[model samples]
Target: MKLKIINSDKILYEEDVFYLKAPGLNGYFQILENHTSFISILKKGNLKFKNKKKIKKNLNIEKGILKVNKNFIIILL
Candidate 1:
């Protein structure tokens, strides 16, 4: 799925990712290929995603919004 991370200034990251794990208000949650679409508020923590090559990455967000639709993930920080 296509994953894009952006803030007011610029696009932080954009790529196709196989898996994603984020810090939700309640706890940590994950997004996978073909997962259902939803939007949620994010807490300050580490945001993680694994690319097609299985390389893991971490993005730190202070607070943000997460939206998933039609296999596209958008994180607004």
Candidate 2:
């Protein structure tokens, strides 16, 4: 899946991800390749994702929005 993280100023990240974990408004959720399309509100918490190269990254995000469609992820913070 392709994931992109963007803010008002610039693009923070753009890459292919194998797995993702996010802090949804209600709770934490996970995403993988071929996941269903959806959108959600994000809260302040740790966000985790693994890349195609099997490298894992962690981010502490503030409030934001998350959009997922056809294996593409867009995070607006």
Candidate 3:
């Protein structure tokens, strides 16, 4: 899935990710391609992603909102 992270000023990251691990209100959850569309609140933690190339990275995020649809992901922090 295509993932984009943005703030008030500019886009932070944009790429195709095979998998995503995010911090939900209750706990951490994972998202993959073709997952159901939904929205969730995010907490401060390490967010990890596996890209199309299979490269993985952990990023520190503050409070944010996560939106997931058929084609893309928008993370606003």
What would the per-residue lDDT of candidate 3 be over residues 13-46, giving only the tens digit for each residue? Answer: 9999999999988999999889999999999888
Compared with the true structure, the alpha-carbon lDDT of candidate 2 equals 0.94
Query: What TM-score against the true fold does each predicted structure earn?
Result: 0.97, 0.97, 0.95
Q: Which candidate do you rate higher for TM-score, 2 or 3?
A: 2
> What's model 3's overall lDDT?
0.93
lDDT of 2 by residue, 1-77 (tens): 89999999999999999988999988999998898999999999988999889999998999899999998999999
Residue 5 Cα positional deviation in candidate 3, in Å, after optimal superposition: 0.4
Better of 1 and 3 by lDDT: 1
lDDT of each: 0.96, 0.94, 0.93
Q: Report the C-alpha displacement of residue 17, candidate 3, in angstroms.
A: 0.6
Ten-residue segment with the worst summed lDDT in candidate 3? 50-59
| Best-first order by TM-score | 1, 2, 3
> Which residue pairs overlap in candidate 2's backbone?
none
**Top candidate (lDDT):** 1
